[model samples]
Target: MIRTKIISTWTILLVCGAQAGILESPNYYHDYAPTFHHYHPQPRPQPHYIHCTPEVHNVIEVIPPPVIVRVVEKRRQTAKDLLDLICRALTDMGGIASEDNPEIGARIIAKLNIEKDTATLIYAEWKDGVNYRSRRFKRQAAGEDRVKNELGDLLTKAGDVIESDKEKLSPAAQDKIDSRHERAVDDCQADVCKSHAAKRNRIKEAKAARKG
Candidate 1:
């Protein structure tokens, strides 16, 4: 009977030790349990953007407009012809040639009021040694008109010369001379004389046309 009782006590001690060990175990189950993860998801890598090169295009250059040039024509006149006409008129007047008589060159230079450049001879006349007159002709309209008017006066004097020497010239010679004078008059009227009148008229007309 004593052996039986010792056996029972030893069995009870073993059972209590087993119950305490189960309560102290790490995997013990209860009403609440802590959750744990061994494999964590790695942070999603950031998305990368691909770089692209820009396309190059050729540039066009702009040019400015060109400038326009205008040209103007200038008219110039000289006085040489008027001196010759004057000398011829004087000779036709039947005056004796004298050194004291105005030379064509001197008369032209004197009559011309040109402050610059030389006056070319155009026409000349002399009465005795002191009385002399000359016309410096220009082709300008103003000068041409003056020459035309003066030429008409000269024609009257020329007629007197012919009348005074009517016996010296045959009727045919006088007719011929008269015809020449008439032709000269016609030319002057036509603005074809080597006088300033024609040139001035032409220039005036040209300027008017341009304005129009």
Candidate 2:
């Protein structure tokens, strides 16, 4: 019986020592346990800058307008001057005499009254036994009136031709023609009484010779 009791006591102590060792092993489990935690990096932002621009302007130039001119002209000679020139040309051509035929002079003067630079009428007068009678002759009249009328017609025609061909003649040439025409008329009418004086002298000499 004692042996049995001692063996029971030794088994009880062994069981108690195992229970204490188990209870002290809790500190080792706490020191070796894993912890729950998370770590993250934060991002930084960049700075912004502002840009500037410049403005421009344009310029233009203006111009002025042009000018215009006009011109006017006047006649060189009058119509009366042209008429006198025609009459003078006729007398120079021996178509009419300054004396003896007062009828021709009267007709010319009357015709000149109508117009200066135009053709005029010239009538023929015949001695009807004692009195002078006036008559209109056709284009074939053979008297001084016909000659004068033809010359006047010629001057009128020449004036027309000159007007048509005005560009061909220079101003100097026109002046020369005018001067020549005037000189011819003046020469025809110059020294009228000189011939009468000479005739009277010849008559006086003849009378003296007869008396001697």
Clashes (backbone N, CA, C under 3 Å), per candidate, total 25, 0
Per-residue alpha-carbon lDDT of candidate 2 for residues 1-212, written as tens digits (9 for 90 to 100) = 99999999998888667645644654332222243112121233345876544432333455666666666664433223434566665443222311323454344334433433343332212112213232544323334333444433445333234332332445554454444444433332213223433554699799999999
TM-score of 1: 0.26
- TM-score per prediction, in order, is 0.26, 0.20
- Sliding window of 10 residues with minimal summed lDDT for model 1: 113-122
Candidate 1 per-residue C-alpha lDDT over 59-136 given as tens digits, one digit per residue, 9 for 90 to 100: 546688898888876433222343344334434332321122334323322322231111121222211212224242
Worst 10 residues of 2 by lDDT: 123-132
